[model samples]
Target chain A: MKEIRVFSPATVANVNCGFDVLGFALDGLGDEMVIRKVPEKGIKITKITGAELPYKAKENVVGVAGLAMVEALNLDFGFEIEIHKNIRLGSGVGSSAASAAGIVYGINQFLETPLSNLELTAFGMKGEAVASGNEHADNVAPCLYGGFTLITGYEPLRIVSLPVPEELYVTIIHPHITIKTKEAREILPEQVSLKNAIKQTGNLAGLIAGLYEADYGLIASSTQDVLVEPYRKNLIPDFDFYKQTALKNGGLAFGISGSGPSMFTLSKGLQNAGAVEFALKKALKEKNMKSESYVSPVSKHGNRILEQK
Target chain B: MKEIRVFSPATVANVNCGFDVLGFALDGLGDEMVIRKVPEKGIKITKITGAELPYKAKENVVGVAGLAMVEALNLDFGFEIEIHKNIRLGSGVGSSAASAAGIVYGINQFLETPLSNLELTAFGMKGEAVASGNEHADNVAPCLYGGFTLITGYEPLRIVSLPVPEELYVTIIHPHITIKTKEAREILPEQVSLKNAIKQTGNLAGLIAGLYEADYGLIASSTQDVLVEPYRKNLIPDFDFYKQTALKNGGLAFGISGSGPSMFTLSKGLQNAGAVEFALKKALKEKNMKSESYVSPVSKHGNRILEQK
Candidate 1:
């Protein structure tokens, strides 16, 4: 194939109780990349659009990911990548992951030497490392795998795709603000009380069970965060107002998505999701905060080839 | 019904990564309680067997559970309970939960009132409180509902029954040593590093996914405990030897049963369970420690009515 275009979805990591371990992909809000094989045995970034991100191949997530994949697979061919970043950077919505995963996914398609999802994830992690100075896969895995994902172990890199209930809808409100992942992570406590740890563990277990059994009530009740949300909520404007407004208006569960500036709520159906979105947007409007909202189902396909020529 | 006999199975609490949040019931090890109605309007404990325990109604777990049930239901009938304790106390195998849950289960059967499982769990928590000075439902809930149970929340007392794969077998080795639950709890660190806490959360989410999907490899890999087992394993003699032996002899996962002297290992099949049991017992014998071992499938029924007359 001469060229391949792929779309990689955005993801909301943590999912309330599962900080740094659990995440789910969204049908909307993603990044697209186009890759074309070149004669020279080198990687290049041809163009960038939609968001202000680094353009230099070595500094860009897509270029870094492409380099990692080429080196890991020992490819002799060159490739040029075009980035269309739809997911916002510093929005806590896995924007970097979308670009990172999309480029690798696009290259794998163009070369027809598809790497395993796990292997692709490792390359994506390298991209994430370039963006955040840490190789974290919580966002990348879900962005690549689709649906809900659990990063069970990081040392050997174990990722498990969890079941997602069919009726689940996600409503995300991204205020026009920025909270870098590094800053959000630095504010977290070095240690947490055993009491909170136990509570967090229970919530994570309950959430997983809820997903497996398709129990919406359990999922709502279990999507509580006693560990990360308390510390990171400060970075988001009117975080409590958005969360409470969403829940009071029929949202099943609500929390700061990933690090912050972006918040999400889960609902059972489209009607409830619409209500939650309306309420959240109204609350942000009343506060005079410029924000964008997207209501989408949990995406089942994380990254996919849009076209090939 | 004039009288009812019920069996409440023993449970292993804090199943590795899920300290104070996860537990599973055993098939054969349990406490049997026979409850009979009388003319008086108060609860009483008439007899005790197999273990030395208090006979006073308020001082014993069975009586406390009976009292809780009676008060909650406003039942105006007297009851006499006979305890046949098969699960050893202070063996870290939820001995107190078995007794507390067995009596309430028998009482519920004789009355035919059929309290909801959550209500029964609440009453069972009262029983556990009488034994441990705190109302904990980790063990009691699993003993009441069977299979794997997750105590998602404590305020409203939420309990979720998780799926158990069919090929799983459990082997428990209970040594003749005592480690009080209170002391075992006291030795735990007041706080854990945020790093370890996040790791534990991931393992729990993974394990729940493993159970729901019936993935043995995921279960084995996710069964590791980084929070509690390292501290409590010291109370068990030859803990490292027994754990290593069980894993080497075909066990999929191994950990402390509850708080102390007893240890448990999970295997994929009967043959594996037999091998694990044999290896574990041989190791215990070599240490000059007398221990009892039971190999059984995961109990599907938490508590059951043996007979009604």
Candidate 2:
């Protein structure tokens, strides 16, 4: 194929007790990209829409990731990419990750020997680092592999795909606010009490087991964050109210999605997720806060080709 | 049944990547107890053997745990317990936990309505606290519930039973030395760096997933401790040498069993475990360090009645 169109889903990182180690992708909410082979010998960005982003190959996340992939493979042919953003930028919902993962995923389809999703994640992370100021995999991993992803280790970049419950649903609320990933990260304490550290590990381990067993009660009890939420919640408006509303309205767990301004609730079924969405929107409305919200089942697949020729 | 004899297996608590949260029971090494109903109104420890321990009802771990269980249920009858110690004290292999769990397990057999294993763990922790200076459940939970146990929460005492691979084997080496649990706990840092804490959570989550999927490779990579091992390994003589030897000899993972002195290695089969045992013994002997060793599969059941009448 000389050209291909792909869809890359957004993701929720720093999940509840998982902190920097776990994440999951969202269905039907992400970025779209169209890439075509050109006669030139380098990567290029031709068109942009739905959001303001740099067109320069060196400045944009997609270009950065695509270039990294191209340079690593030493391709003599060039490719031009058209950008379409559906997930908002700086929303803490892996906006940059969707774009970066989409381009690499799209480019891979054109090659006779396509890189594995795992290999693509490395290039995706190169682009992700441009936005977050550090190389982290929680977002790009789930965005690449789909379902629930646990970063087992970093030295060798190990990623494990955890089982997702059939009834699992995700509800996301992005308040009309912005929290930079770098600043959100900076606000966290460098040292955590040994006691809380143990608690967090217990919760994370329980969450993993709960997912495997499909035990909702176990998931509820384990979806608590003792490390990062206390500090980042201050940057978001009425964080406690949103969390209480989500849980009170049938959400199993509530926590900041990624670095914040955006929040997510995990529920058992789509009906319960809708209820959480309705309740959270009403709560935000009562406070006169404008926001965007969505409900989706956890995405089963990450980046997928929409069209190819 | 008015009388029962029970067996409570020894356990390796504070497992790698699961400090203060994970543990597993041994197959054959444990404590044995005999309990009988009497006309009296309280619990009593009538006999002691194989170790020097207090005979006073309140001063003994078995008595403390039995009394707590009886008081909680408000039983109108009392029981007498005969103790036989096999696992050494202060061996970091759940010696006290076995005795404590044995009495409650034995007492439950005499009741028309036996308590659940989960409820029995609470009483076990009570007796365990007398020895460890804290109500930590890592050892007791495994001793009561068997296989691998994870303490997911402390406030409500949530315990989770994790899967054990069919071929998984355990090799334990208890050096001829002693390290008190309280002193070992005191040596831990009150605070841990956030980076290492996240790393620990990742390893633990991976370990839980590995156990469920029976993925030995994942277990090998995940069985590492960064938070507590650095500080505690110094207390155990030649710990690094022992660990290297185990890893070199087909052991999947190696770490301290609990606080110190005893170290455990996990391997995929009986032969691998035996190999690790031989290698570890040879390494210890070369250094003129005396130690006792045992090899067993991970126990499937916790406490069991050997005789009832």
Candidate 3:
């Protein structure tokens, strides 16, 4: 029997400019899952996770995703699944997406990779119904495919995986704090002013043009958010400092990560990602808070196996 | 001396699924302005629109737009300006936007086209301020340009004038009944559910992708509006038939145009456009509702002067 262990990186949705409409994966932060086909009747989850998760097997973040594959493939042999979580859960770092990615990735392996990335993402998004009670693909698509991806219409994914610009750098700061994604969602205003939506449309358009045209300045400028950020920024520690400091150090734009206590910034020509990492650290410290910061390129591939036995 | 006269089309801001974000210009409706410049030293508002106007030269709808132009370029010129009427005067089809567009267009010509289209539109958006007491561009850009445009951002619009896809067609129906744009604006609920916003985000994302990829099927499906349409559709007369009939034909998408009394459908093929328009006219006739229907392709240029002398 072959046992394979894999990891899928965390993700950030909205990306400031593309609020609720765009997302991408990170290379490092995420979760791990291991699975092995066993000589059993039907596939089932064997363990919960490294951290306590809700809803036993059915509520299992990645478990539901694996179930989808089993149902779709009409599998007979059961498989044992185990998960290891690394990303900060509920920090808007796509913690749930990692587990879901693991299930989809491992099951694809078990199924001999029958489904395409689009199909796999569709099944994985069903797992979102368990995690967030919403079948949102912003985080899941990127974690599955990597890079800056636009999840337009998810039923076949219909993802547009945009090339990460050469001059781009990203900085992420995860504060050692808990801000429930649901809680973050609760604070959002029901109706945004028409003006903000218009602005967002333009910014998102510019952001897309920037990516295609390789106009860093336009992308940087377009990354400003007006709708969700103004309401949500009040929850993040050192929100203004993290952005201003990072920009001063070479970052082009900054905004909250998903529904965040974690925040991120984009940069142009800043090679030493650590400078941004340190800058955010300093800002958090000034707020009497301690947060871990990450500086890495946008993940180009979403989930992958690290080892097999 | 020479006289220059032109018409600007009314635009729908916050395109259905893109609430507060996307807008498009429509043909067959808007405001008209006439300008004649003489080798003189001053500017004069010789005649204001006689139609159901706001009733003053300085405070008139088109007057504010003219003010934005003179102030922007710091140009002093002797000219006689006249505001005329057409377009559903109070419909959300950017009734006031035409005024803004006219003022800017008139000034540009009167000033010998010193300002580019970019500068002219910015000057035009000030007319929105006259109407809503706020400056906005979704209406002005198309009113000034004469085609489909993407208003990417603001202050100075991050605008993109895009090519309308050859397959795309629009069917518009204007009922003889009146619904003031302001009254329609007041009908919007003060708050919207977060769930709805999330749905809209998905729809908006899908719509943008559909337009970009030229996937008429997706565009049709993604044109849904969970937040605004349900509430506002109630205001239009026989909206259901208009919507269903359009879709039953070859229409890819259908929704209320701007505020009320008008509805539009996007079609992937011209056959669908004609069919939808035919169906709408037929339905209106059945209801004994006097109405006008048009099957026009998406305007490629928003506010270009067809002729000037």
For candidate 1, what is the DockQ? 0.86
Model 1: residues with Cα > 4 Å off, grouped in runs: A111-113
Q: What is the lDDT of residue A159 in candidate 3?
A: 74
Task: Write the residue-wise lDDT of candidate 2 on A1-309 in tens digits.
Answer: 688989999899989899989999999899899999988877899999989999999888898999999999998898999999999998889999998899888888878898988899989999988887878888999998999999987789888999999999999999998787668878999999998998889999999999999999999999989988989999998999999999999999999999877899999999999999999999999999999999999998988888889
Q: Output the TM-score of candidate 2.
A: 0.97
Question: What is candidate 2's CA lDDT for residue A4?
Answer: 90
Model 3, C-alpha of B56: deviation from truth (Å): 8.2
DockQ of 2: 0.86
Task: Give the C-alpha miss distance for residue A12 in model 3, angstroms.
Answer: 1.6
The candidate that wins on lDDT is: 2
lDDT of 2 by residue, B1-309 (tens): 788889999999988889989999999999999899988877888888889999888888998999999988888889988999999999899999998888888888888988888899999999988877788789988988899999998789899999999999999998998787767888899999998998899999999999999999999999889999998998888899999999999999999988968999999999999999999999999989999999999998988888888
Question: Native contacts retained per candidate?
Answer: 0.85, 0.85, 0.28
Off by over 4 Å in 2: A38-40
Checking candidate 2 for backbone clashes, the offending pairs are: none
Interface RMSD, all models, one decimal each?
0.7, 0.6, 3.4
Per-residue lDDT of B178 in model 2: 78
- After superposition on all CA atoms, how large is the RMSD of candidate 3? 4.4
